[model samples]
Target: MSDEGRLIAGRYRLIERIGRGGMGTVWRAEDEALGREIALKRLHAQQHLSEDELATVHERTRREARSAARIAHPNVVVVHDVLDDEGLPCIVMEYVHGTTLGALLKGGGALPPGEAARVGLGMVAALRAAHAAGVLHRDVKPGNVLLGGNGRVVLTDFGIAMATGTSTLTKTGEIIGSIDYIAPERMRGHKPGPTADLWALGATLFQSVEGRPPFRRATAMETAYAIAVDPLAPMKQAGPLEPLIEMLLAKDPDERPSAEETERALRVVASEAPGATMGTATGGTTEVAWASAVPSRATATVAATGPTTSAGATLTDSGSGSVPPTPISGGGSGSAGDGTGRPRRKRRRLLWSAAAVTLAAAAVAGGLYAVTADDGGHGRKGSGTATAPTASEPSPVPAGFRLVREKTLGVTFPVPDGWKRDGRASAEQVTYTDPSGLVGLTIGTVNPAGANPESHFQNIEANTKLNYSTYRKLRMQRTTFQGKPAAVWEFTFQGQVRAFRAIDFGFGEEGGTEYDIYLSAPEAQWDTHRPVFDTVKAGFRVG
Candidate 1:
C-alpha cells in the first residue's frame, strides 16, 4: 500500500499500511465523517476471483460486522463499518495500539510462566463473552489476542470465525484456520463449531508458554504428521508453565478446557508471574516489532510454515512488551502452502519406471485419524524438543520431474516441488510421487494404444474419485494446469483419504505427447491443501 492517500467507499482516507495477507491488505485510515482512525481491510486480486469465493468473503465480512457489532464487550475488538471497495469487500474496524504477545517472547523468547497464564485467561474471558453472544472465534491464536494500553486484552479479526448456533458459511470440505491451529475434525474436512475455537486457543496458549506452537515439523509434510499424530504437551522447555498450558492445549476438543474453566484456571495461575501487582506485570523492554513497539496494538516476524504461514508469521501479541521473531525484510515473501492431504501407499516402482503396477497390486491403508478431545483438561507436556530447522541444511528438492512433459504442442510448465516425477519408457504413462514417496501419480498419454479421448476421459472420471473419513464425492472440472487447458477431478475417500490424481495431456499442433497429472493424499489433508489443486491448474501450461 502507498503512503499517498486513497479514499475507500468514498468516506475513509488511507493513512498507512497496517498488515497484509494472502486474503487481503489492511490499512490504518481515517473516517472523514467521524474524524476517527479506523483499520481498513482491502482485498487485492491479481487474477479474477471466483464468484463463490467473492461471495463467501463478502458474506463473511457482513456476518463478522454484524457479529462483532453485537458483542460490545471490552474484551472484543470493535467493528465500526463494512465497506465494499470497488467490487471487493472490506471492513473498517477500531484500531487498537499495543504490542503482541509473540514479540514479547521472541526478543529473548521466554516469558514468566504466570504472565503467560494471565494472557491465556484474558483470551478466555474474551471467548466466553463472544461465545455467550453466539459467536465462536474459530481462528484464535497468539496474534488475535491484542493488548490495550489500559492493561486489557481485546480479541480481533474474525475472518474465518463462525457464529455459534448457525450454519457455516463454507461447505464441509472447505478447511479454514491456520493449519497448525486447525482442529483435527476440521483437518478431516468437518465443519467445526465452538470446539474448534478451543482447539486453536490451546495451540495459541502453548506458544505463549512453550515459545513455539505445539505441532513441530521440518517441512509442511512433517508438521501435518505432528499435528495429526502428536499430543499437546508443554513440558521442560516451558515446564514452568505446566498444568495450565497442558489444560488449554489439549488435542481433543471435548477433552480441552472450557472457556470458563480456562478463565478460572488462569486467574489462579496469574496470582502466582513476576509482577509488582497482580494482573499487572506491565513493564518490559518496549522495543518490539512493527505496530507492536509504539503500542496501539502489535505485530512481529515469524516464517510461515507453508505458503500460508508467510501471512501467518509473527502474530500481533498486543501486549505492551518487547518484540521477537524475524521481520519480513529478513525473509522471503509469499504465501506458505498449496495443498493438504494424508499419505497414500503405492507398490515400489523405479523412480522413472515404465510399468503399470496393477492398481490392485498396492493400496493406501485406511485408519481413524486421531484428533484430541479434551480427555484431560490440563494440557500434558510432551518430551520431544520442538525447534526450527537448522539454517545450515537446505530443504531437499523432489527426486525427479520425469512426470513427462508434452513439448510436442509447444506447451510445458514446471511441476510443484517435493513431488517425484516419472513417465514410462512408453511415454504413455507418467508418475508423480508424494512427500513420503509412498503413493505416486499415474499419467496415461493421449491415444495410448487403442485408447481414445472419450475412453480416457472416462478413465480420468474413474480415477478422480475422492473419499474422506466420513464422506465421498466424485468432483471434476475443466481447467488448466501450468497454462495448458485440461480437465481436473477427484473422488473423495473418507477415513483419512489418500488418492492418486491424474490429468490427461491435450493434443498439440501435430501428433504430440498428450500429458496427464494425477495426485492424491490422506483425508485429514483435503481441507488444508485443497488450494494447491487450483494453483496447479491455474499454472497449467499448454498451447
Candidate 2:
C-alpha cells in the first residue's frame, strides 16, 4: 500500500518523507492515539532480501527499538513503538523538529568550538547512559545526532547497538557502521566496546569543527585502510579540543580515556570556549576555523546556501556530510557574546605529554568547575552557578600551608605552600600536586544517592583492576570517618613511567553524598607523602 496519507497499525498517519537511506525511508507521521507527531521508519528494499536475511533484518529492527528504549537519558531519542506495515517492520521514534548535526555542518560549515562542545556533552551523556545499561551504540555519526528545536541535543538511530554479552547479529567478518568513523580495533575484527563509540564521537566532533571527517578518502576500502593503519592528521582547527580528539582516536581502545574522563574534558571545553558563530542575519562571527582554508568564495557560497551531501560507498553506512537541514535562529549573548567570538579569558593549553599532564591541562583550560549542591542528605538542590567564597569568612590556612576554597564544589582545604593545584576541578573532583608531578592529592565525590558505600568501592575497584596496569590492592574496608560511615582503599599500580602507591578514604554525608580524598606517590616513597594525606583530611570541610 502507498505509505503517504495511509494509517499504519490503525493509528499512525504518514504525512511526508523526511529522510532516505539505502535500507529505509523515514517519514513524518502523526500518532492518532497520542495526538503527537512521530518519525516512522520502514525498510526500502524488503523484497530483495532472502528469507534468512529478511529474518535477520527484522530481528535487527526489533533490537534497535529495544536498545534505544533501554536508555532513559535526556540526550537519547525516545522509541515510541514498533509494528508491521504491509509485512515490513516499522520503527516509531520521537520526531525531533530541528536540523541534524550533519545538516548544520552542511549549511553552516564548521561550528564554533563552544557550540561543538555543548553538543559533545550531550552525546557523551547519552553514551554514558547507554554503556551503563550494557548497550553499545555501534553506529555514532553526525547524521545520527539531532539538534532539536527544544534545544536538546539527542543521539538517535541505534539500529546496530551491540548489547553486552549478546550473540553477534552480523555475519562473521562483516564490519558495520560508517567506515570513516570506525575505530582501528573494530576494523581489525575486535569486538566493539564503549571506547569504540567514543572513537566515533571523536570523528563526529572533528567533522563538526573541521567540516570533514578525519579519515575521508575516495573509496571505502582506502578509508578503511587508512583508519586501520595510518596516523590521524593533526587538527589545525580544533585548538584546545585537539588533545581530546587525539586521545579519543587512539589506535588502541586501552589508551582512550574512560567516558568519565572524556565527559570532564568536554565539560571543560563547554564551560570555557568563548561563544558560537551564529547565522549571517544575526551579524555574528563568521571566522570559522576552516574558513580561510577554502580557496574559492564561490565554493564557500555554495556550501553556505544549502545542505551539500556525500553518499557512503558501503551500503550499510549512511555517509558523512549528507543531511537536509532546518533553519536555526537565536543568536548568542553575554558570556556567549556575539562579537568575534574569541576567548575572553586565558586558558591552560593542553600539554599533551603524559596522563598526568593531560589531567592538568584540562584543569588549566577549564574556566568554571561544574558545581553540585549537597544538602548533607537533606536534598540539596542542584545549581550550575559558581559560588566564590566570602572574603570575610575565608577558609583558614595552617602555618606552612595555604587555604583554598573552591566555590564550585563548596569545599575548602589547605595545601603545602610549595604544592601547586594541577588537576582540574569539576563538581565531581579536584586535585593538587607537587611541582614534580609524582606526588598528588585529589578530593572527589561520588553521588551514591542511596547505594551502599561498600558496593560503590567494589564496583570502582573492579574497573580499576581491569584498567590499571599491574594493580595491587592492599586494603579496601568499610570504616568510620568523623562519626560517619566510610571506606578506605589502598593500592599500588604502574603508571606510564613509574610505579605508584595510593590511599583513598570515602565518607558518606548526611544526604547520601559521598566525599573521597585520595593521595598518590612513588611506591618506595609513600611514607614521606602519607602525612600530607592526613593533613588534607584534617583540614577538609564541605559546606
* C-alpha lDDT score of every prediction, in listed order: 0.46, 0.60
Model 2 misplaced stretches (Cα beyond 4 Å): 275-543
- RMSD (CA, Å), candidate 1 to true, equals 20.8
TM-scores for every candidate against the unseen true structure: 0.52, 0.53
- Cα RMSD of all models vs. native, in order, equals 20.8, 19.2
Quote the lDDT for 43 in model 2: 75
lDDT of 1 by residue, 1-543 (tens): 454499887889999886777877878889999898888877776366678877776787777777888788888888888868777778888988776665565643655667776677777777888888888777887667777777788788787667766668865445566666776445434446576677677677677766777775444332433443233432665543454454344333333445665565556556544552564222232111111211110001111111111011111111221111100110011111111232221111110021232223222111112000001101222211122122233322223322234442233433556665432111122334455543333322332111222223333222112212322334444433223334433443211123322112232111333344333333344443333332332233444
Stretches of candidate 1 above 4 Å error? 1-3, 46-48, 103-108, 279-543
Provide the clashing-pair count of each candidate structure: 90, 5
Candidate 2 C-alpha lDDT tens digits along 380-448: 122111332232444556577888876755678788788766322334445566656566565555443
Against the true structure, candidate 2 reaches a TM-score of 0.53
Which pairs, if any, clash in model 2? 348-364, 376-510, 376-511, 377-510, 377-511
